[model samples]
Structures are given as structure tokens and as C-alpha cells.
Target: MTARVLLVTSEAVPLVKTGGLADVITALAQALRQQGVDATVMMPGYPAAIENACNLKQAGNLPELPGGPGTILHGVMPGSDVPVVLLKTERFDQRTANPYVDENGAEFDDNALCFGSLAHAAVSICAGETDLPVPHVVHANDWHAGLVPALLRMKGITGVGTLLTIHNLAFQGNFAMSAAADLAIPDSMLTPDQFEFWGKMSFLKAGILYADRISTVSRSYANEILTPRFGHGFDGLLGARREALVAIPNGVDTGAWDPASDRLTVRHFSLNDMRGKSGCKRDLQQLFGLPVDPFAPVLAIGSRITHQKMADVAIDALPGVLERFPRAQLIVLGRGDHAYEQAFLGMAERFPGRVAIHIGYDERRAHALHAGADMLLHGTRFEPFGLTPLYSMRYGTIPIASRVGGMIDSIVDAGLQGTIPDDASGILFDGEQAQDMVAAISRAFELYARPNEWHLMQRNAMSADFSWSGPAEQYIGVYREIAPVEAQALFDERSAAVNDSVNLPADEEAAEAAAMPEYMTA
Candidate 1:
């Protein structure tokens, strides 16, 4: 009686990953299975995914798409038992490099055709055109899979509910209206009420219009998108479907992110004994070629270098921070926005050993930074749901973040009155100016001078739970709301049993955590 769900996404961790979306899809699917739901992941067969898959077998051939027929391959996700379906076609097979962009950082020219075929195949499978079981719900993530819901409705496929999750509204999949014929979208469905957005065909708009439900990554983000400031021109459309919109904050894989067991770090440590953190600090300083001064506060940046991420603000605030704390060092790791990249490189050059910059991403280095650094610097203008801050907090590294997006939901600012009775995880500052970040850094330095208070804050951060159990329960509730009566009863019974087995703290901390945000807790 369990409702079957097909998680349609463009990327998934271990197989392919471009951002946090990959991690969310993989972890959420696994969490759903633990909650007694039958979940499967469906994605295009990029070269990396095909190469990494084990026990792969040909499932069947899909119905003719705009480009040609696609062959479906079945395999299990590398580290888990979750089943995965890989759509194999000429277009997807040709994408040997990055899934969405080319070496030059430009989106592939045939992106519309590439993703359109994925959606068409999803609809065909759900409509009984394939040999696979029909999913009770088709859960699509981001613009890459946005066309699934629209195609489902256009084909008049019944009994299949669609849930579209908007990870970031800024990257809407927009293409010229003339490409509709190439994408095989019917002309009748091209009105402003459907896929049309300001005379252009918007794949994201189609999903928002046709999906049975829509979700954002965080509660504050869900509310922010309803206004003109954060909607990116889709505010009015999303406002019309306000009732269907919900927020399910992203969660961290505690097992994979635990500081006690993480193999990526040089030394393992926990709240019980933080001596290993000093060893990790020395290792990080050695790795980055900075002075191995354990007392010098290490501030790390592990986010993409982009304007929205406020990488410029982080860079601009460094000089003032260095002037105040002469021994402070900064280590930056991530790649994006050539301008920001050059700016960071320039900073590293200007301040020989104190500043270190890595132009690209390395999973091991990121984990090391989170475990080794004293504080994580995140100055984002707008973020849907950032996973790095959560990861950092779990490692007992305090976050110095801007007061926006998921940062507001996740980090409990020490300065915020009445937020927590005796604990604070991080520091928060408002505005997008460099001066704002400098002030926040100044406050962080002042707190760092008091080891007792700083260690107490670290304990609070390490004790915080950002696991998937709560988010999985929330998602199950959404599924039950759209599922049949029999399925609803089955879900309710399973959920009750699951909730009973979970042991949450029975003190004021639990109550305060629960009251923080709807998406942060059950």
C-alpha cells in the first residue's frame, strides 16, 4: 500500500554533482526508503554516471522523443540499495563533460532539447508507455526536470501527482519560443498561463503552473519568493499557487558529515574532546602553506565564487579583518565568476602566506576546512538552502554569515536576543556591503578572544541536529496529502512507528529548536 515515487532529477551525488541539489536528491531518496516508501531515482546517463554504476542492465526502450528513442538502464546507486533509472540517448551520451555546461562555462546550446527529452520520457513511463511500474507521484527537482509536470498534464495522464521543487528560482530554464517545435511542446500550451514567460518559453514556469504541489528548500525562502525581490520575475505566478507551495529544508547526511568518522580530515575530534581540532588546524595551515600558528584564528570559505554568494564582500572585508587581527588567516576553496576568482587570487598574492586560494573544488579539502577552521565565512546576498553552513556547524566550526535565506533558518546567531537561552552557534550581520562583513568579523574576533564562551558556542553548534529524519517525515506528509486514502493510512502508520523510535532531547533546547522554523524541525 506504499506510494511509489520516482525522483526525477538532473544530478545525484556519487554519480554526478554540480551543487547541493545532487546531495539533497540522493539523501532524500534514501531517507524515503527508510520511512517505508518505495522511492527510485531517474536521471540522464551522463558519462560519469554510466561509468560509476554497477550491475547496470538495460530496462527497456522509451517512446520516441523529439531527438529519438531513449533506452532506459537500471542500476543501483553506488553506496546504497536505492534503484536508479538512467535515460540513454544520443544527446545525453554526447555530454561527456559537465552535465549542464561546457568547458567555457556556457550552457550547452541544445540544453532545451536535452532536458525536454528527459521530461518526455518521464511522462511516457508514467502514462503506461513503458514496461516499468507507474509512479504514484513524479517528484521533479529544479528546471532541469521542470517539463515533467507540464508534459504529464498535456498528455492527460491521470492518477499521477506531480511535485516540483524549486531549489533556486534565479536559474529558470528559458529558451526562445521558436524552440517549442523542436522540444515537441504543443503550441496550444504556450500561453502566459502555462509555459510562456514574457514571450519566452520557461520550463520552470510550466512546472509551477501544472504541478500538484510546489516546494522550496527553506521556509524563509518559500516566503521570500512570493515577493518581487526574490522571485526573479515569477513572483506573480508563484503567488497564484500559494496554497500548493510548501517548504522542506534540506538536511545533512550525519553519517557522512560526522567529524568523529570523517576520513577526509587529518584528525578526528568531537565535542567531548577538541584536542584533535588543534592538530587539524596545524595540518590545514601546513597544507595551505600558511604560518602554522594555532592561535591565529582561521576563517575558511567553501562556497562558489559568485556575486550572489557575496564572494566579493568576503574578499573586500579581508583587508580590514587582517588589519585588526594581524595573525588571522583565510583559506578560500571554490570556483566560479572569473572576476571573483581573479580578485581572490589577487588577495592571496597581496598577502603572501596569510591568504590561500584554491581555484577549484575538492571534496576532501572542503571537509578538511570545515573540521580545521575556527570559523566559516559566508556572505551571501540570497541563498535557497546552503548546506555548507550546516556541515560546518556539525563539525563545531562557527559560521560568520549574512542574515538571509537558509542562514536565517539554520544558524542561531549569538547576538540575537531570546533566540536561545544559553547557546549560540554563529554570528550574523545584515546588508551586502563590505563594511557590514567587517563589523561581523570584528565581533567574531572579540568572541574568539574569550575561549570559554567560544568553546561553549562550539558545543551548541556540534550538538545541533540537521539530519534527514525530520525532513523525510515532512516529505511523507506531503505525499500523504496527495495520495489515496489507503496509501495515506499506510504512510501514517509507518510514520508513527518511525517517530516513536526517534529519541529527541526532552529539554528547553528541543522546544527552542522546534520553534525556530517549520522546516528546521518536525
Candidate 2:
């Protein structure tokens, strides 16, 4: 019996992506399949998700989810051949732009009801109500799919173990306690230790309390959440489950983020070759309407413009940095709060040729920003995993990032005073002010003057292995830890046959993939 996993999330890549969650789901599913886990991705059938599905076909019908009835659509991810299960219901089919939010960025009115339907749909599939076979475990992501573990226990469905991956703890699905009845949330489960949080029902708390095992995106974040600083008022509940919590870092999609083969990069460049990056820089400068100066260093911001990301600080600090480094150009790409958007727009107007701002998200432009820039300014108050910094590093763009979450785990600072120049990937700073970011970028510029040292740091950044092979097996261990004894036997047999990676840590589990090596499909 093959150990099957149903990976559930609100978004996925190449179809819909609001943040790093989508890419993680797509890549992790592909990597899991390679290690012989029969991984199937489950998500709401948004119009794009349904349309982009490869070999789409009707799988089964969902009876009565919270909102209404739905059908299960089966297919494979377009690029990665991992199986996809979509719940196509009236609520899920209605929204077109930004799955969670509307055109103006306001959340949908019936978000609780709609996501309640998603949870019910997952349980329906697992209870053998649909044509698809029951998975051994249901792997839920973030607060969007947080209700699954609690719902399973409520309905007395005991066959499947549950694992919840907290991508961002801040976005807990907290709603009025009155809405619980419409969501079919049982009154019994509403307690301080369970779904209840300060008289309101929280979807994230439900998963934290009920899931057999829980995992955060990074190891530091796992420990960080157990404290009051990063707990978001759920520290006590999370502390109780600390023993079950694990930290599994996210993997980069090399096929999509790699500089050498990325279609959106316009020009290809790699570690061995140095000529193409200059051409890419010129192309970016031309596209963004900046002066075509190859000698000028381009500092880029490729992230959401919000308080958590400290976009306000960047807006205030950039002027001083730009004035100091006279030749350094700044490129801003991403959209969020209207105030921040307007602020960035104002910035472009103030510094005409020196500062260029594109107040929206475009995949191609994001790639170009990384390919062109000398350094990326990624400052966030808290980050589960800083994938953007990793993406920039892939293009030999050093990131001057805040020392939080995965940034601390991934970036090896280019020494305090050129101490470990050889091993340094990027610069990391531990401060939370506008001046702090300035000081960090100052260090980056100082290193930038030393061309040989800067090139060595870029080489270290590009040579990093953020691929999925290692992390996939660690997820298997978490699954096996929670699995039933009988299921564990089956899982172990399959694991041995795949790569002999049954009891290995994530870093030590990178053996040859035996079962399904062809991850991406046309």
C-alpha cells in the first residue's frame, strides 16, 4: 500500500499566486511524488485553476458542503505532474480576481462560509463520499485549510492523520463566534484550548490544537511562535503543542527561479558565465525607463508593500541611500496598501531617473528586477521563509535583508568587516528601523566596491542548494510519525524502496530519487 498524502491549500503556482504559499505547494507536491509518496494537491477550483489544469476530468460529486453542493475535478498540475483535486462549487466559482480578495483588495463577504465549504469538501473526499480514494494523511496549509483537522475529529473520521503547515501565523482565520453555526462548527469544540480565541472562533487555533503534528516553514519560526513575540496571542496554545512542532524550510523551484533557463529573465546568465548579467541589467534599465548605465548599481524591492514588510521604512530610507551612493538606482515592484502604493508612486516622481516604480505584481517584471539588480532590499518584521531573497540570490543579486525567520537561516552575511568573504552569500542585519536598513545597505555598498569579494559572495549565493529533494523526505518523517502503526509499515516499505530515506533528517536525506524522477510535464 503506497502512503498517500492530500496537500490542501488556498493557492498554487502557474495558476494563482498571492505569495510564497502557492509555489511551496506546487514544488513540495512534485518533490513528495518523487520520493514515492502518492501526493495529490487539493484546492478550490477557481476559474484559472480549473482552466489551467492538465488532462482535466470530472472526478466525483461533493454532497453538501457548508455553502452548497460541489463537484470534484481531477487533473495534474500543468508543469509538475502531481495529481490535483479541485472543489468546484458555487461559492468557489463566483470569485475571479485574487481568490481571497476583490478588485479593490477587500476580502469577500462570505469568506468564512466559502472556506468552511472547502473544509467540508476535504472531509467528504476522505470519508469515501467521493470516487477518489482516502489519503493516509491530509496535509493542510495556513489558515485557509486550517479547519480540516478539527472537522475530521468532529465527524468521527479517524482513519486519516492530519498535518498542518503554518505558512504565516499572522493571518489567523478569526471570525465572529456567531458565524460558527453557519460554518457547522460544533459548540463543543469552542474552548480556549481548541478553536476559541478571545470569544472569537479561530481556524488556525483549531489546527494548532487538533492536528496530530504541526510544522512551520522554518526552524527558527517554529521556536519563535512558542513565545509571545511572534505568537499573535496564541502563544499559550502553541506552547502546549511545541513537542509536536517541527521546522521544515521551504524549497525553491529551480525550474522557475533559475537564471540560466528562466524564460522571463529575457537574457540567460549563470555562475560560470559573467557576460550575460550586464546585458540583463541594460535590458532592465531600458524596460523600466531608467538611464542605461551599466556601471550604476541597481537596488531593488520585489515584495508586497505593507507594514509587515517595512515598506514605509524603505520609502523613507531609500532617498538617503540613493543620495549617498549617487550612482545606485532603485526599482520597486509590488502592490499592497494604497497609502504605500501612493508613497512609492510619489518616490518615482521625486527621483525621476534614479528611482523607478511599477505599482503592481507581474511575474516577468519580478524576474527582470532580480536579474538586473546588484542587491535586493528585503526588510520584513517577520517572515516565515524569505523566498524572494532566495530568488534574487539565484540571479546573483545579493539581498540586504532583516535577520528574521528564514533570512537568518539562508543568508550567510558577507562578514562584519570582510572576515568570511568566501562563504558569505548576502548581508544580514538585526535592526528594525529606517536607519538600520540604511546601515546594512551601507555594508553591502562597501563590499560592492570590492569587486572580487562581491563576485565571490554572489557565487556563494548562486551555488546554494535550495532544491526540494531534502525537504520532501523530512515531511515524510512527520507523516510517518503521526501515521498509524499499520500505515507506518506500508510507508516504511515504500520509503525503503524509493531512496532508503526513512529515518533521515532533511539535510541528510538527499539520496537518488527512485520512483518518479520526471517532476515536470508538458
Candidate No. with top lDDT: 2
The local lDDT score (0 to 100) that residue 378 gets in candidate 1 is: 89
Over 1-522, each residue of candidate 1 has an lDDT whose tens digit, in order, gives: 567889999999888887888889999999999878889999999888989977889877875786777988888999898888899888998888678888778999888988988898888779877777888888999998999988887778867878899999998999889879987788988987778998889999999998888988887777667657778999898877877888888899887899898988889899898889998889888888899998999999998899989988887888878877888999999988888899999999888889999988777888889988999988887788889889999888899997767778888888733333366889988888889888888777788878877888899999988999888888777776665455566554544322211122458435644554432222
Prediction RMSDs, each to the true structure: 5.3, 7.1
Give the Cα-based TM-score of candidate 2 against the true structure. Answer: 0.93
lDDT values for all models: 0.84, 0.85
- The local distance difference test score of model 2 is 0.85
Candidate 2 regions with alpha-carbon error over 4 angstroms: 415-420, 492-522
Give candidate 1's TM-score. Answer: 0.92
Q: Which residue pairs clash in candidate 1?
A: none
**Would you estimate the TM-scores of all the predictions?**
0.92, 0.93
